[model samples]
Target: MLEHRPVVIDRTGADIHDEARRIRAHGPVAPVELPGGVRAWSITGHAAARLALSDHRFSKDPRRHWTAYVDGRIGDDFPLIGWVLMDNLTTTHGADHTRLRRLTAKAFTPRRVAAMRPGIERLVAELLDELAAVPPGRPVDLKAAFAHPLPSRVICDLFGIPPEARARMLRGGETNVDTTLTPEESAANVEQWHREMYEFVESRRRTPGDDLTTDLIAAKEDGSQLSDSELVGTLHLLLATGTEPVMNLITNAVAALLTHPEQLALVRSGEVDLREAVEETLRVQAPVAHLPFRFTTEEVVLGGVTIPRGEPVLINFAGIGRDPALHGADADRFDVARKDKEHLSFGHGIYRCIGAPLAWLETEIALTALFDRFPRLTLAVDEGELEPQATFIMNGRLTLPVLTEPAVVGSPSDVTV
Candidate 1:
């Protein structure tokens, strides 16, 4: 019999919601294939995704019995297994994962996320001012103008990355995140990206700054901190988590609000809490549509079905957030004040996003300033003209072009050009 050619159920926000419904109605396990002969069972139901992801029965270690299910059908070098072999957080398991987690956990505490606020607010204003300078009614890619810079610059700043190195790191950061490439290509790029980022840690350690990287390096220098691999990988994980999702959330949230002017007006007029609203948007449509890939260490079962062993069992991030069974009647609606933390935007269980507070803080400040700034700002190009990031992992409007003319919504200044 021919190997199963997997079908793609959800490629966009609409499809992701639709697919989550489909999976819930059809039960938990769904099949899909990679470019090679590798087949994966995607867990769409939120509860099932949680269970499958957290269960110890699932063998996360790829080296377990690799000869049978995974042979040379692929290649010696592959991206799927590289994640487990390299870096810090993604590669470790058991005691190792636990140890490193303890050291880094302090940095992500709600207090720490809260502490970053003023700096984040200042950064948000700078980004908006830069965007405001762009002529209105003319096309400006909001991705580059506002959505992009707000988080990219914030993350780079938080990590103590210098301005001169920002462009190179930004380019490599996306390449490091792309999950679509062939195994060899992905592996090569991931390693090179880490090597490129090593300087960020080294530069900070040598001449210490008040940024997160410097702090982390200092921790590592103290007793029982992090290994070099853990230091770099954890830093890399932080960047990956911080940049893509926050930017995606900004663009996606702005797009959603712009489309629903009533919602925009409500947020602008202070009828909604930007924090609760940011959570609602993330739940409704997550930017990182797929959770980073995790492996099962042993044979596991979900929805009363067994995943034999060593299979790529994925937790659908976007699908889980929109599951009707979890969110009740208004699950489909985007209401900023909706308090639904049950949604899995930051994930659930041990591996839940540690930087969630940071992510939430960044989005709240950015989106709040966005609607407030352009009380009159509207889309520059037709919605269809915006690019779609086709990769499953990062779902977002590639370039959201919006118009900003006349006046700053709440400001005394008005511009002619």
Candidate 2:
């Protein structure tokens, strides 16, 4: 066993640029001793990282076997997303990922996501309108008003959560997000989040609705579709994964643009283009800081480091995107105008974020609509003052305060965002 030396995790915030810089100098992949009582091989080089992510020898399946971790068992600590998602998504790799991806593939197509845009636009408009009401000169938490709520609202609509349940589920959204706590505490929170999700799913299952939850219920009619544990993992995954990171997208993009006046001007002029800008933000500032931890199914060698079997590998995709080695000198520079697509912000191969499309849609809608509605929108609080969540899970600003001009309400058009 590695000395498992106590590495202090900077739970106060999740800026990994320094860590990435250090890893870049050291080597592509190295052992990262986490602050908490855990350790794993942290992979950083973009090309090498993707190669590792794509290789099947490294498994996402937690049951592959490993040393017992701090706080809780493997399944409880780093489990799958939630219930309906439990049996199929993420946990099972190989043919199982393929099968589940195939079964639900049609649901997330670009056309479908695009079709949901009007609703997403509506949600953005409503959120921004409320944000505009914050008294001027007072710092309003945009993370609460816009960043966090936008994605949850979109997810709620996707699942067809009713108004009463939607209000209840938003709390579920806040709690389910990933954190830097011990495995036991995180798992307990996860189990509680899962119970809420189960009741929500069960409500839909019993009532028979049109949302994705109902569809999932119908899709797996034979209760056999999801095991007890699988259900908990899947639901937790959606609630946490879906809400937290995108909140950063909104907060980070606003901060990035505001900090760079030239970039903000370009956005205002439409000369720089918002989609490219958003994509650039994604590449430049990754919202999620931790590498997706994969266990070594067998012995593997890289850069003179031989990872023994069953030792967990922590591939830090966050750093892979900004590798000066891969992206060149202009790499670190956040230029929305520069089209850089070789980013590792999303994982390589099959493990890449399945919700990327939805996330992109939400971000694109939020950003574009903001500029379109209030060209004068600017941070109400001092940009440097925002409190970013203290965790490696979904690293992002905890709140964003913005002052905006009143918006002209558009027709109440519902587009099923």
Candidate 3:
């Protein structure tokens, strides 16, 4: 038996990196208490995280495997219930997970993701144009103005959601990912999200277009096994997955580059590839802080600790990235040129993020365009003044206030250059 008092993860202050380091000190698998005193285990070691994620004994279906959830201890009223109870590829396992993933994988193929580069470049250019319009020396909140909207717009276009409907989706999506919401608010937000997604599905069905949503509907009509719940759930997953993580990817990558001028200079000067920069950012500052809600099917020992069956397991991606056992002593340092850059930022095995290719494309394009337009961009406030989102699952700044020198128009039409 470990200490009676578990580390409460909810009170992580301004520096979450330090918090992750502190959790890692408690051993690879440490007991933790989330807000409202929800007891769980946190996998804070790199090797242990990989084992937990890939281990078949650890089921992703919380409804089936989580004893606390089955016994009502992890109720719907729980703040994090909205994430765990999701009925899409995230929560499904076995043949069901394989089937659902197959339906969605067609849309994210390398060829398809590559084909989106032109559109993504156009969107990035447009957003950068808007950013350039901001007055010099005036701090613009990049999260709201650029980082957030770039991916949102791309996702909306992909799903054939109208510009008008995006406002509703954005509003509900914001509320859903916000971990600071009260249980009541969280439930309400999730219901609202469901309603919006249902409407989106219905709208797509009524007016099918040359879009992924319409494609999914067609697949269902042509005897694909996607049910109503899966359809709505997948749409919600796409939006949530697309917007929040990708938004943070862009914002976090920019923040990383801004804070690490030496590394940023390499990317800016073409010495280091932007892809490398993005990879480094993903390793050091993964968009999602915690991979919440994996449940053990049977008692399992990891890193010298026994996790009882049916306990909720959280993979601390934040901690794993900095584990010295994997990355040596300089693991905490941000190095775009690091030789060993393996990380679980997008996860591992069959459940790795299906949208990772698109995300990488989006981030690379957005970063390349933004810097090309404003090569001298810098944070407007002290780095310490920037605040991360209050949520433990999502790791990003609430706002990235940045200033740049006046933009000069001398770019070729091709943003990929």
Candidate with top lDDT is: 3
lDDT against the true structure, per candidate, is 0.69, 0.66, 0.82
| Winning candidate number (TM-score) | 3
Q: Ten residues in a row with the worst lDDT in model 3?
A: 408-417
State candidate 3's TM-score: 0.93
Sequence-dependent TM-score of model 1: 0.85
Could you tell me the C-alpha RMSD of candidate 1 in Å? 4.6
User: Which sections of candidate 2 miss by over 4 Å?
Assistant: 1-8, 67-88, 167-178, 182-184, 220-224, 339-341, 405-417
Please report how far candidate 3 places residue 16 from its true position, in Å: 2.4
Q: Who is ahead in lDDT, 2 or 3?
A: 3
Error of 3 at 114 (Å): 1.5
Tell me the deviation in Å of residue 297 in model 1: 2.6
Instruction: List TM-scores for all candidates, in order.
Output: 0.85, 0.84, 0.93
Angstrom error of the Cα, residue 19, model 1: value is 5.8
Per-residue C-alpha lDDT of model 1 across residues 1-417, encoded as one tens digit per residue: 232335554333334555555555555566665434556777767788777657665544444433333554445355444454555656566766667777787677787778889998998888888877775445577787777777788888878888998777776557655555667777777677777778777777789887788777767423678877778878777777678888898898888887778776776677876666666777887787765455666676676666666566667777777776687767778776666646777766777777777777788777777777777878766666666675566768767877776534555542221
Q: In model 2, what lDDT does residue 79 have?
A: 34
* Every model: Cα RMSD to truth: 4.6, 6.1, 4.6
